[model samples]
Target: MMLKLRVDNQEIEAREGKTLLQACLDNQIYVPNLCYLEDMESPSASCRMCFVEIEGTPQPVPSCTVQVKNDMVVKTDTPAVRQLQRTALRLLLSVHDVDCKNCHANKKCELQNIAKFLKVGLKPKRLERYLKETLIDETHPFLIHYPNRCVLCGKCVHICRGKHGESVLTFARRGFDTIISTYSATDESSLTCGDCDTCVKACPVGALAVKESS
Candidate 1:
């Protein structure tokens, strides 16, 4: 069955029961999303980039987690939506080091595109940028981790547990002390990881990365 929805003041249709993000993509709405990798079965809802306004709702909701309904009205690019998106982008950028000029993801990063779209201004709050030692796993031979760039979005853990049947990676500690590391005291290099790379691909902010093959 097909469902009709209003997005960005335009009427669009998509398959019923599919997620709003799927509906928007089907209709070319092009919502920016970080926690929603198209091929990944997991929906982490951590990045909050795919937020959209619905008629009669008080605040914008995550499109990736919302299901489409017939006659529903959705607003993806309204002024309020834009402002919220800008704020969200600013928050994500706040924790990240925006060294795009020299970073590997430079021109190709999704967060960079969102930053450009949001036209992020100088942050209202200032703090020291903490840089952690990058986590490297020689046992996997295909992955790299820069915890400083990680936004704690949990996409990697979701991918590992959801798609690979491996629960090797988990977040430890709490609050500002939280970091993505392997279960218990073992490191990623020592864990019997399958090296699926799903976690690397699911990361929205370049936290987990792939080493270019030589």
Candidate 2:
């Protein structure tokens, strides 16, 4: 069933069960987001970048987690929404290594695109930058993981699990210490990732890369 919604004073039609973020995106309305994928059964909403103001809502909400409804009024460029998005992006940048010149993602990085869209600089002015001590993890025989460049969006993990019944890549630790961990050598040898590069391709930040020799 198609539902009609007014976004930024523009009328759009989206499936009833589609998320507000997806709905807006489908209609050519841009909303900054990182942790959302169209195939996700349940959006993590961890990025907190897709905020929008809906009529009757006291505060801005993450559009990725909200279902589209008929006659819904959404404002994607409200002041409150921009404030939340900027703050969330700044927080991500605080811990992110912003050496884009040398990074593989460079001009194509999602973080850079989001920063441009929000008119926020890649560096956080008020927040002090804190990067992980370990720069790269070559534990995986076929892949290289860059901790500092990672946004912890979990797209790689989700894509891995979707491709294989189970994922060899999983999030480890908690809070600021969180990082993606791969399976043990013995376990990884039995998995199909040796022949797969989906996870690397799914990463929006180029944090994961296929080893050249692999």
Candidate 3:
């Protein structure tokens, strides 16, 4: 059933069970997000973007994790929401390579899009810049994994699991050491493309991509 929700005082029709993020997009409202994929068993909320202010809530919440409720009041651009998003984005940029000039993702990149949406600089200023850049893994015949550009969103992991009934990509380590890799980071033979580009296409950032030379 279609239900009406109030977003920034604009009423929009959204189906029940749709995440606030999805509904906002459907209604042409922008909500900055990187880790959100529509069909997934779990909401990673990894990127820490997509915050929206809800009335009566103590603070802004991740719209990707919030289901649309009838008469729900959502403010997507509240000052508190902007503050949280800016902080989260700054941290993401700290470790990222920030080499957009020639990067494949370029204008299509979600990180770039969200950074523009929030009017936040790609370079981390107040946060200490991280110097470690994970080695680029070109093990796969068709795909490349650039850990330096990864935001640990897990979109590739979910897509691989859904399309193949098994996950080739998985999260490794914790904290600053965290990364996305195959069970065998050096095993190119384990990859079975099955004629599907689901993983590469589902990637929000350019962390995963088809080799141009493939």
The Cα local distance difference test for each model comes to 0.72, 0.92, 0.85
- Residue-level lDDT tens digits of model 2 in 158-180: 99899888898899999999999
Q: Which candidate wins on TM-score?
A: 2
TM-score of every candidate: 0.80, 0.97, 0.93
lDDT string, candidate 3, 1-214, tens digits:
9989899989999999999999999999999988888896568887889999999899999999989898998899999999999999999999898899867889999988888889998987788877456558887667788888888888888888888888878888889988887745455556667456788888877888877776
User: Which whole-number lDDT from 0 to 100 does residue 128 have in model 3?
Assistant: 82
Specify the highest-lDDT model's number.
2
Clashes of each: 0, 0, 0
Stretches of model 1 off by over 4 angstroms after superposition: 38-42, 121-142, 183-195, 211-214
Candidate 3 whole-model C-alpha lDDT, 0 to 1: 0.85
For every candidate, C-alpha RMSD to the true structure in Å: 3.5, 1.1, 1.7
Q: Give the TM-score of candidate 2.
A: 0.97
Residue-pair clashes, model 3: 0
What's the alpha carbon RMSD for model 1?
A: 3.5
Better structure of 1 and 2 per lDDT:
2
Question: Sorted on TM-score, highest at the top, how do the candidates line up?
Answer: 2, 3, 1
**Across residues 65-168, which tens digit of lDDT does each residue of candidate 1 receive?**
88889999988888888877777777766667666665666666788777666676534255545545544433335566666677787777777777656666
